[model samples]
Target: MLSHLPTNHHLRPLYRLLALASGVYVLVFGIIGVVQTSGAETFDRSGDATALGLPTNPAFAYASVAVGALIVLSALIGRNLDFYVYSVVGLVFQIVGMLALAFLGTDVNYFNFSVATCVVSLVIGLALFTAGLYSRVGARADAH
Candidate 1:
């Protein structure tokens, strides 16, 4: 279905760029998760054990691989408004998750870093979404 779609020349570049950025982010994060969870004995957050109940094992490695695959697929298949929508959703989730992590944090330094990263990610996501919207509008205008 994707192969048969006509090219919107104006939006194609923007879509590809966004897709690449998102895919890279996902892949990197997933890999980090895999490394962190692999044979990680230090349990800094005991709350995670109760809340997420994720076993510190090879399962996380598999999850990372799956995430990496999904990111690649999304980058390849995602285009048009779907890219913008998914980006927004991901940013929102990151913001909320970071806020929750901050609230649960005992250390000021960690909380500060988490909040800062969340803010930066949210800003970037908003900018990307705005660019996507503008690209679509510009394309429509040029077409008309």
Candidate 2:
């Protein structure tokens, strides 16, 4: 189904850079969240901890750090590995954002996500998806 997708796109470098920046942002945010919520329980849902203007708890913070690191590594090792990673991760983020939005004010909001976080997640997801779609590498004959 994706056979028509472009390869060796002119904007591939820009897309890759965007993905890298998103990874760094998530990583830094998670680190700050971990520090800010150090006193709280690992999965505590009662605290009002925040990082980079996004609501977070220890669990979410740690998860973010791991995900961010993965993205960073994938971007660094780009070759098509990044395309797959970014695509999958982007979809996951999009799902997470929607789920977070659905459970915004309820007890199921384990991530402590605010509207801003949801918005940012969606944006980042789209960015990553775009990068994945166009950042592919292949032989010159494959560019057709």
**For residues 1-144, could you state the per-residue lDDT of candidate 1 as single tens digits?**
333333355665675566457656545655655565555433333323211222222343344356445545654665454455545545654564466456635653221224444454455455444433433322444445
Clashing pairs in 1: none
Candidate 1 segments exceeding 4 Å error = 1-11, 41-71, 79-81, 84-91, 94-98, 101-113, 131-143
The prediction achieving the highest lDDT against the true structure is: 2
Q: Give per-residue CA lDDT, model 2, range 1-144, as digits (tens).
A: 567889999999999999999999999999999999998987777658889887889999999999999999999999899999999999999999899999989988878888999999999899888888988899999998
Which stretches of candidate 2 lie above 4 Å from their native place? none
- Report residue 90 deviation for candidate 2 (angstroms): 0.6
Candidate 1's displacement at residue 93, Å, is 3.9
The whole-model lDDT of each prediction reads 0.47, 0.91
| Model 1 residue 133 distance off true place after TM-score fit, in angstroms | 2.8
TM-score against native, each model: 0.49, 0.96
